[model samples]
Target: MTEVGILGTGAQVPDRVVSNDEAGAAAGVDDAWVVRKTAIRERRWAAPEQATSDLAAAAGSAALRSAGITPDQLSVIVVATSTPDRPQPPTAAYVQQLLGAVGAAAFDVNAVCSGEVFALAAAEGILTRRGGHALVIGADVYSRILNPADRRTVVLFGDGAGAMVLGPGRGARVRNLALHTFGELAGLIEVPAGGSRRPADQAALDAGLQYFTMDGRAVRSFVEDRLPLLTKQFLHDSGVGPDDIRHFVPHQANGVMLDALFAELALNRAVMHRTLTHYGNTGAASIPITLAEAARSGAFRPGDLILLAGFGGGMAVGFALVEW
Candidate 1:
């Protein structure tokens, strides 16, 4: 079997920044309240003219450049996103065209916030099977789906994208990857309409059903109950322990949830990397964006153990253990 590893990473956020004061005013709250609740001081929102593909392509191009590879060298392009440019074509198709990846296979993966890690696992499988480079991108334009008046969901999401170049060569070796889903709790976090189950009709629009919705308390409870078990299982399967991990990059959910997770796992807070304070929750893009930022900051050393874990709206959990 061929070995697959990450060669490079890149991330991109829209030019527009939304500060907590701005978002809080819209939510009828104060900046202090917003920070106290989520620990997000500000985040980036995509311009009206921009779409998910735009962000994905920018990040993908950067990743390719970081890896010193050309578009033609890519064998596959996997974009993990729920917020596609359109319902007809996969967002990956538009991203591939924009990046001029003419030789690569293109598709989309919808694992919501756990998307990037899921895409990484999928890309690794493709590379190990086919012997070529793959570009995996996770991008989302949550602002488009946000109900401006709905503070809970609107204040928690932002728009951004991240990408990784994976190939069969020496780099961050992917030692173990795992993904699981709990469909029973899918409705805890989701867009109530815009899908086949409840098409985007005037009634849906009138009811504000097209907007994103999340039961934050329920989500936290779910995480508290599920994450530790999942982490234990993941560590066991990978034959590694918490102390062996030099860095624990989890989904940029928020400060409170992350703090709770750190306590639940009993891991050192210093080893945890978080981007939510500045970026809010960029959905699928969170994990990779944090990973890219950390890589650029010289956080990893050779032979270090890095753990990537993400859990979100599919009620999904995905993780990867890498040896840097």
Candidate 2:
């Protein structure tokens, strides 16, 4: 089978930090209450003028720099974003132009938090059959859609971007993609704008459902009930056992969720990567951000086994097995 390896990774975030106290002051919640429950102390928010595309461009440039590749050399640009800069031009086009990848097949994806993995699969598929370099970026300035007055969500989300450079098969890099989705729960969490189902309207704005909301308790139930089964199947399909994984980077939605996943898989403590402490939950950008930081800091060994798992809106879930 042809292989596609991640050549580099990069990330970006705005200057603002919405701490629990700040969110509490804005949305009426106790700082301690926020910490005890979600385990998040602070989250970043984009400036009023900053758009999601700005983040994508920044991270994409960083990835190109790290990969030692230039914009003109890129064959494709895939940007994964549920929160787009505008309704018309796909965010990828801006990134492509910014990176000087003028003639590439640029586009955007809408897999919510599972976007990074989704874009990864798309890039892997494209590179496997065709021959060219592709850049995958997941950047979200979620606060634009956020109701600044809502506490549950305003405290949980942050703005950031992450990028990865993908190309022809490299030695034991990304082995395969184990991606899955459950559309029935699509409404569990979503934005009702810039799409067919619920086009942007005064109605959605009035209802205050245009931003983000979640059945946290319900999603937790789903994770506890389904994640184990999914992980097992993912492992079976990839022909890799739990014990073989050297590191686990599950979604950064919450610390407790990650703790549950790591303990369930019996993964070692040393290799687990967690950046939520400093970056908070960066939606689709979390994985690449952590991975890039690790790469830059020399955190991985030649024989390490890395697992990437993410869960998000639409009840979407995905995992990838890689040898680093």
Candidate 3:
């Protein structure tokens, strides 16, 4: 079997900076309260003209450049996002057009924040059979779906995109991958309206169901209970131990929760990468964005073991091991 690996990575965040005071103003909170809860001081919000596809394309282009690959040479373009540019036509289609990846097949994956790792697993399978490079992008425009008054969701999110180029080339060689979903807990985080089950009608709009919502308490509990167990199992199954991981790139969820979880995992040798302090939880884009930033900074040493984890809506969790 041909080995699949990450060839390059890139990330793009909007220029608009929203401080804690700004994000919490409408929700009756202050910087102190927000920081105590999420450890996020500021985040980037998209400009009025920017959408998910635009960011995705920019990150994709950067990833391609880093990989020394051209757009036309791509065999697949996978965009992992919850906030698409539109309901119709996948966001990856727009990204494909923007990058002039005319030869690539494009699509979108909506595992919420877990979409990036899911997309990576999907693209890896495709490339193993097709023999060409794949551009996997994780992008979201959470500013569009957030309800200003709902601090639970609004204060914890930002808009951004991250991308990785994967192919049969030198980079971070993928060693193992795992994904799990607990559908029974789907209601823990979601948009009540906009889907077929609950159309965005006047009634829905009147009730403010179009905005994102979450049971923060329940989500925290879910991660606390499941993440450590799953992560251990994943590492064990891959013939590795927690101490063997050199770097851990987890979903940029809540900084507080991450801190607790990291301690519980006790990956003594791993450096946990985090970007939520400045970028907030950018849904699917969090992991890739953090990964790209770390890679660009020359953080990984050759033969280092990197573990990527993502968990979010659909009550999904994804893990992948890479040998750099």
TM-scores for all predictions: 0.98, 0.94, 0.99
RMSD for all candidates, in order, please.
Answer: 1.0, 1.7, 0.6
lDDT of each: 0.90, 0.81, 0.96
Candidate of highest TM-score:
3
Clashing pairs in 2: none
- What are the clash counts of all predictions, listed in order? 0, 0, 0
What local lDDT does model 1 show for residue 282? Answer: 96
Off by over 4 Å in 3: none
Two-way TM-score contest, 1 vs 2, winner: 1
Residue 277 alpha-carbon offset, candidate 2, angstroms: 1.7
The residue ranges of model 2 lying beyond 4 angstroms of the native Cα positions read 169-172
lDDT of 2 at 127: 82
Q: Write one digit per residue (lDDT tens) for candidate 1, span 16-67.
A: 9899888767678777888888888999999989999999999999998988
Ranking by lDDT: 3, 1, 2
- Name the 10 consecutive residues with the lowest summed lDDT in model 3: 1-10
